[model samples]
Target: MAEISAVSEGPRTEGDDYRGIMRFAHLVRADLPEPALAVLDGSQAILVSTLYPDAPATLQELIAGGSAALDAVRAAIADGAAVVHELTDFTFASAVLAPPAVLAVGLNYAAHSSELGLKTDAAPTVFTLWPNSLTGHGQTTSWPRSLSESVDYEAELGVLIGTAAKDVSEEDALDHVWGYTVVNDITARDIQFAEAQWSRCKSFDGFTPTGPVVVTADEIADPQDLHIWTNVDGHMVQDASTNQMVRSVRTLIAHLSQSLTLLPGTLISTGSPGGAGYSRDPQIFLRDRSTVTVGIDGIGELTTHCRILG
Candidate 1:
């Protein structure tokens, strides 16, 4: 276990008025096939790689580098020494590219549990998500109709752990949070019910679309008080608040930490609200060419285009 608190001793932020919390994300340029870490600056993106010679290349690196690396990047941004590019010139990537693990909660919302015909356990229902399922905002997610035609959408809040935490108390759980982002826990509904486990049903390639940006933990006042919702094609499908969650972010972290150390850069998707397409009067599914957007107020919106293959 390393020290959780680290004070930055590198180049200091030149101005106290730099403005805005550092919104971090991976940005992809046509020339650069791989995504690069960047800070979203209004209409521009400050490449973290160009910020300083030793800047972290990804969110996981930044988290591993701790406050020192973050402060250095902040200082470089405020010092105005790095080159920046138009925000529109580059496409977005998952705020979290790779993590130690991708944990998710299920039936955490009463409405979602009731509608899906599942029971919300006295303790949280947690599961693991595969890395292959992770994709960025504005990307296309396709599936073979032959595999499963009943794909569904779930709007969820994603939490990123900044430090290794074990057996943490509920009161201190939030201290380990690095940032927050949006996650659409897309599921194959028929498979979800047919299978004894939830991971496989939801872990298809590109099934978990996240990001656009990861707002630092400090930017979010209360994770349990934000607005979380979803839209399919053009209509609003799921609309609810994080307040509706059966277990708060802190509670989930505390409980999970009791079992093992949540390593740095681990992501915990806090589960979805009600209004799953499967539970509607006339059920809906992500059809070919359909689009879905799941968003969290004060954070960012994540969109995924759907394509169904024969």
Candidate 2:
């Protein structure tokens, strides 16, 4: 089994209650006859099949039991009948990993806003992350150190929507969530501070490292009550609570759904809490050989090794 950790809970699904959600800390690669949706729990990679191999991998698979697939897998897991495998030899890919769009929020935390010297918008500051940037776990994310030695990391709670939402009420917004994942919103801080646009700085190839795994929505009772943190090398650099978020996850979704259709399989990187490297007294950028990991109390910790080329 790869390392596993627990975090706080988000709201439970109506009529269906569960214990805390469990996410995989290791990478999962499937070797099957057809396209498959599988989750690695402990030492097993449980297969989740939708309509058929050719059927598209939709958010519904996981969200609507497609996302909830883990639930069934866990039943077998409890019975000691899981299909456990040695991941040491398997290649890995991003979890839920491929989504319709990756949306990120900016300055949702007061501390982050102050550190970046930016004013919070009366409405939420939202941006998109390109798909080309998605990378698997334990991968080296590098850039020209010259691109901006000010590279930083933002530990954020990533929400994977389960259903299509449009003009949703905050109370009902979370119902559309399939599960949650952690996101290292790795950033080029200098570019972030300099550009009016946010996508480019945050969307550099390999900047977003998501998943070790995705925990179902039913498992989390309250998304607002988790502890999020980051460590560089061995030092704790960023630490804060999800409760500090200016707008709760529900609120952010409600707001976004108002202007755009919040499609199923959308990955929303909620803003990070304070303690970004660029805002430190002496400043702490991700240096060569730097190993940075970001985690939420119940979700999982996402680690990325950094390499800066001159």
**Who wins the TM-score comparison?**
1
60-112 in candidate 1: lDDT tens per residue?
Answer: 99999998888888777777465656444567777799899999999999999
Give one digit per residue, the lDDT tens place, for model 2 in 1-310: 1232322223222333223435533244445442345454444443434223332243334554554455554543455433334445454445655678899999999999998898998999998999978875567888996788888999999998878889999999888887888899999978976889999999888899987678778768899999999999999999999999999999999999999998877999999999998889899999998999998987777788888888
Query: Model 2, residue 143: displacement in angstroms?
Result: 0.8
Quote the lDDT for 86 in model 2: 44
Could you report the Cα RMSD, in angstroms, for every candidate shown? 6.3, 6.0
lDDT of every predicted structure (CA atoms): 0.88, 0.75
Evaluated with lDDT, which candidate comes out highest?
1
**lDDT score, residue 303, model 2?**
82
Cα deviation at 161, candidate 2, in Å, is 0.5
Model 2 lowest lDDT segment of ten: 4-13
Models 1 onward score TM values of 0.94, 0.83
